[model samples]
Target: MNKVKENSVFFVSLLLTLIFIFWGVFFTENLTKVTNAVYNGSIDYLGWVYLGTTLFFVFFSIYLLFSRYGNIRLGRRNDKPDFSTASWLAMLFGAGMGVGIVYWSVAEPVTHFTTPPYGEGYTVEAANTAMKFTFFHWGLHPWAIYTVIGLALAFFQYNKRLPAAISSAFHPILGDKIHGPIGKTIDILSIFATVFGIATSLGLGAMQVTAGMHDIFDMPNTLFVQLLVILVATILFLISINTGLERGIKFLSNAAIICSVAIMLLVLMVGPALTVIKVFFNTTGLYLSDFLQMSLRFTPFGEGEQWIASWTLFYWAWWIAWAPFVGMFIARVSRGRTIKEFVIGVLIVPTLGTCLWMSVFGGTALDLVQGDHSLAKLITQDESLSIFIFFDHLPLSTLLSILGFAVVAIYYITVADTATFVLGMLSEGGTLNPSNKIKMTWGVIQSALAAVLLLAGGLDVLQTASIAAALPFAIIMLVMSYSLLTGLKNETVMQKGNKRNTQQN
Candidate 1:
């Protein structure tokens, strides 16, 4: 009877993943209608949700780093850094911020070039707002969400002898006696959410790559091209996941991020470096000044509602949606890490990457527009055209621009690859060592989802789907908060006893 039930659980998990894959590809158009409504409905408090999450994380991170809780070590039998700290941070950030940062480094700045929300009146160096907005999006708050879950997963998995699954965090509520079918159900939901959430990012990345390619090469955007890219992404991730994080995924992440850094340096030298720096700081200043007001504004009228729903709210929901997949990666890598090290690394280093990237892509677009009367307005005419206008002003023009487009293409693949690997882990009952077959299956699932979303209208569908997945997780996050708080309270006593034993001995 128990064996039969175990097999049944596996079948149900498999069924959910297959269903999501189908939804992502074939039914994504209809799926988008449902998802967009959820997106629209979330708008009323989505801004506050993001702001509150950000603030809680900032404060929580401070507590973790400075308090005794920071010293808490996790993992089996003994506590030490479970993974190399640098490798750990890289994987976590690469999985979490990889695609969004890549797409926005250019798209965001271009959006800001014409009518930056805060300082629409900043006449001279409007691109400054572009850089600042990048910081805001990739800053401390977003990382906080990942950090909270990472801490919870690591603590419970290690100290409590639980699997590193989201439901495992609820052990205090359900207890070990409630394992089996109940536990499997939670695991299934996590897997389903992780797969769809990641596919959403992969799909969006593919579309951005498509648009960027169209601008650079004048190639027609077609389903055939998108599918080819998706397949490549799946294969890359399958190889990486099979090889596991220590070998393949680590090398690939390091290489991809390094290549991106080199591209940014190239843009800095050729584009207006001084102007980019200045505007980046300028945007930062403006964002800080208006942070609270921007955080809470409902903006229920005109494009205000539309912008908030599509732009800011979309970012909020997307981050929330991605919370599970990315959050899980962070948790896995964070074993043996002091809370202080994990929190700071997760929050601060990634923000630097985000700021610089925005400076490169956004600043370049702004400079092209500001320097040339014709290109300035062209930047905003269509998001797809901004890259073309900016490249028009580059040193090698067409050649460098094509390479730039290729950079984005590869970046998307990297994003998809990481998403595929992570989703595999989720489906494998959050096992520390998941099977390669599971990884490959999830990879294929995400690829199919991306294809469906792209064919249905690109990122709009992806965004809608991702946000809807997150709404349920919002409730999950809340439940997690109480469970984590209870766990941390118990951990405090355990630490005191350990200290006492050492002193008495």
Candidate 2:
């Protein structure tokens, strides 16, 4: 009790809870609507920029990793349950892919089957552009966001005397003055970015899950189901937050991965393995060959606004909203790693997961549509029902459905829990083992906030609002590029000077 008394986490948690409750009561629908407008209005070459920037970062990070910085290792480890290579990958996957696995694994693939990116001439076998599309969104650049954050924090805090936030990625150039109000401002902004980003995901994911329930079980798409999911998700988060990393988060993370993989296998056998593999190769090649052109291609402004919004803008908003949490979560797991190791494991491995997961899950869905027209109708009529309709095509529908739902349930737990856990750490100034009460507080806040948005705006409103917040943070992260470069050079030069003096003496 005393531990909870003077702690800022407790109060911050309370404040967030109140904010969520207040919004839930009155302004949720308003927030949802405003955000939607903001999101829809911003289209163009956004995907091009998102994809372009991500590619640049991926290449650039590889360059830096081979340089001297690549060799530097950081982080302080205690004997109890230290992290491993797999842990890093698991954490990265758990951070975003949990909710993502459930949501996009079906919706995205089907969306592409209907619209197929490279246009009408390509047969479904030759087309199925969704896997490539998912790969591009989920791949190297997003991981670079995480790589930069984790490397900076690991190097700064463990190797040097800096704090473990991504903003510290700039400390090498900024120097001691970074510790003043400037640092605090950056820190606060980081916190704000993380919250808004994850909030959108919470609302988006909760709504998706609710939609899934309605589709699968024929449950009414009611406010109550959304609320119940939010409430239940929050309770799980609180439990994991209190239990801390090893026991709570790890268990859920592993569970999610197992479920995800098992479902993929099931889908492959039941759906169509051969076609998805071929399409995966074809689309991946397409994604890679002209990566730069596509990444920077902001569909000509004159080209239909709706088309641009549906693809590029939506992807940009999703990535931007996800960056901070993914970045921070990557930082947390990335202590005691070299720059190269961190980048490859976090950025590369997860990209593979995204690509393959999309291939199998999305791939299977598309194959079914090609084989059976009714499958296409299910997708076009209701994106949420697409997964179950695919299930209906299978021989063992009952068993697969139970397994699929179980996977989704555990995945949601991992996502909601990890999100709340990261939030608590951010607000508490990067405490490794933050107070249980503090973690629980953020957990409850996130759950409540998500519930409100789900009830008022549904998925569209919830997701759009999160994207609106991304516009500003995008600039902030770009600014971070300058700060990181400036800081890195200064730190590097100073170290050389110190080494020279020691040799002379």
Candidate 3:
């Protein structure tokens, strides 16, 4: 018999997810209304909680880099990183953000430019604010959330020889209870969060791919086309997962990084290069200067409250929902690095890269929108197709559009493959090498969830479902942070005691 039957975490999570997906499919209208209400209620009531927790994660990540535990390696003292620095960064960047960067890079800035948080639409100020907040949304806070989870899991799994699972991070606090109901609940929440998180991404990627196909080949942008995109992408990912991480995920990631950068460079070279460079640095500076103001900006008495709730709060919840999958993937590739190295690499590198990408893609798009308001209309019509429209105005429009489509497709595969591996691990008692059979099962579930959500109500439904699923996982992340601190403190005390005993002997 398959060990899945013996794994409560896997079996229970699968049962619950199936029930939820069935509800979503059969009662699309009711599920959509309920999920939207829950999403809004959580934002209205727990918006502050989201802001406060995200800020704490950011601060805590920085502290880990300089703390006494900084030198503690994730694995044994003599172990080195399993992958090259370039490969490691490629995987991190590709798995962590990937398709969203390409999809949102232009679309987000244009949206904010037209309806900024606190500025006139389509003006220079709105353009500047759009890029700044874009940087803020895609910046360090999200990575910090991932870092906390990744560090905790890696520390326990490698340093302390615990199972490679989110629940294991709580062992320091809950002790043996981590293996009981408490631990199972935490792992279950992680699984739900990972599935919805990846499903949302898959849905978004499908729309973008459909839009690109429409833009390039004049295909109809209908639900049927979008479902087809998801089906084909899922099949490709399932095949990719069978190759395992080393040959499949790693190769796809490296290829994605290269192709994505090429598209960015083409935009920079063909568009206003100097303007993109200037906007990037300026927006980055603004982001750092207004980091606090942006992080905690909840407008109770102002008109911008809805905007903050929709954009900022949504991004925070999405990142938290994604932390488990991304964090676990980071941990898997980051076995031999120290806490300091891992923290700095995760928190700093991907963040700066995101800023540059936003600057180039977003900057160029914003400039075009300002000059010709018609460009902004394309975005309002369909956000997914906006990038392709933006490409139409630049040099090598046809080639860049094709490249953009390829990047989205490859990113979808990378995310699905990585999620399959991580979800399999979570369900199968944290086995480092989960069965391919289990992985294929989760792969189908993920694709099914995305397809159902797409049929239910498209992007809004997808976003609402992700935010709703993320609520419990947010609490889990907070507890994980506390447990990590406790674990590190205990390790420090043990080190000192051993040092004193050796000296006395």
Candidate 4:
């Protein structure tokens, strides 16, 4: 009974996840119907909330960079950073994005070009718009979502000596209540969001890996192949989780970054090198000029509304759903960094890296698709094959495809590895070092959820699950910002009081 009471959050979250997996696996059609209903309703009614709240986080993150607390360290003043700067950037970038970026880099640009949000499709304007919006979707807004939540969690956990859980960030508002039902409820919500969000990525990774196999090795693109991909990646990530964060995840993250850069450079050298450079600069200008307009963009009474819902709103919700897992993972590794340093590292570095990636792969794809109706049609039929198809037009197609496979597979393992660690921390009452047993449990559950999502309805079902779980968590993140401010204000007051007392004595 005591053990159950102590680990009540774990037991409850596990039961909920198992129930969901059963529904997705057993009643696949009903699960699809219900999630699709929820997904559509969310877009129809609450789409504005997703846009507005994410924009607010962007502003809030910018505010913190220059706030009075900018110099405050995440841990004690004397504490030093655990990892080197390069390693830190690689790990956070790897955990925060990984499979999604690689999967989308070529696919999204080609997609937007063929079916843009506005104006005529398959025009030069459409190509320009495609790159601009890809930058927007993968840029500052998502990182802001990760930044504020991560900043709050790191502040409370390291500075205030609180547990390393989502609920702990609300101590200022919830007080002792954070330890009761309210706290457990918050953590449970986090678990659901993390599970589904990571599952979505896992499903995407499995699909893309399967696509690579089919394109390069002549393997059939079937459910069995996808499931096999997931199983193999699952075993690797589980091993990574057991090896702990410092060794397994760190090594893989660094390697993934190197491999990713290699692939990008190879594509740039072999395919439209000058066009990619021009596209990078041109799109950066457009992104800056139209950042605010696009940040709050919605088409309520117009032609592009459905497109916005399908693409922009979906991307926003996916990022929010991912916030807790990525945020906690980032905070875990960000001890001893000051607020200013944290923001630049977390927000600036990854956004620039992602935009550059989009420019390279997306630019090359755009250039290739010109006057090539069949290639465009092939991509339009299935986006998972976009990158592989793009490679077909390049020299040494076989080598490039193999390298791309390696990058995605590595990212797949790294993300699942990081996620299992974060899930373990959440389930074990925010312990920095959760036992291997707890980590293993979450690793298996997430892999199962990924497989079920794939089996149920493929990509559409995965997007719905992410958007459905993200709405509530977006609200939670907004509240967490206020709590963090309250905590910071109180800390300043206590410091001033102590200073006066010491002088008097």
- Report the lDDT tens digits of candidate 2 across residue range 1-505: 6654434433544565466456545876666566666655554434445554555667767776777756555543231225766665776788856776666677666776666655652255433456666676666666676666555565666656665555566675566756655665565555555655666667666666676676568788777877887787777667677778878888788777777778788877776789878867877897898666656655454544465457755666567667767776766766767666776787667877788878877777776776666666676676545566667777678777777777767777777777766766666666666667766766666666666655555445555656666666666666666665565566678778988999999
lDDT of 1 by residue, 346-378 (tens): 876776667667766776676665656556666
- In model 4, the Cα lDDT at residue 125 comes to 99
Task: Please provide TM-scores, in order, for all candidate models, with all chains considered together.
Answer: 0.88, 0.87, 0.96, 0.97
Compared with the true structure, all predictions reach lDDT values of: 0.67, 0.65, 0.89, 0.90
- The local distance difference test score of model 3 is 0.89
Cα TM-score of candidate 1: 0.88
TM-score of 2: 0.87
Pick by lDDT: 2 or 4, better one: 4
What total of clashing residue pairs does each candidate reach?
Answer: 2, 5, 0, 0
Winner by lDDT between candidate 2 and candidate 1: 1
> What are the per-residue Cα lDDT tens digits for candidate 3 across 115-164?
99996998999999999999999999999998999999999999888888
- Shift in Å, residue 150, candidate 2: 3.1
Clashing pairs in 3: none
Candidate 4 residues lying further than 4 Å off, grouped into runs, are 456-459, 497-505
Model 2 — which ten-residue stretch has the worst lDDT?
72-81
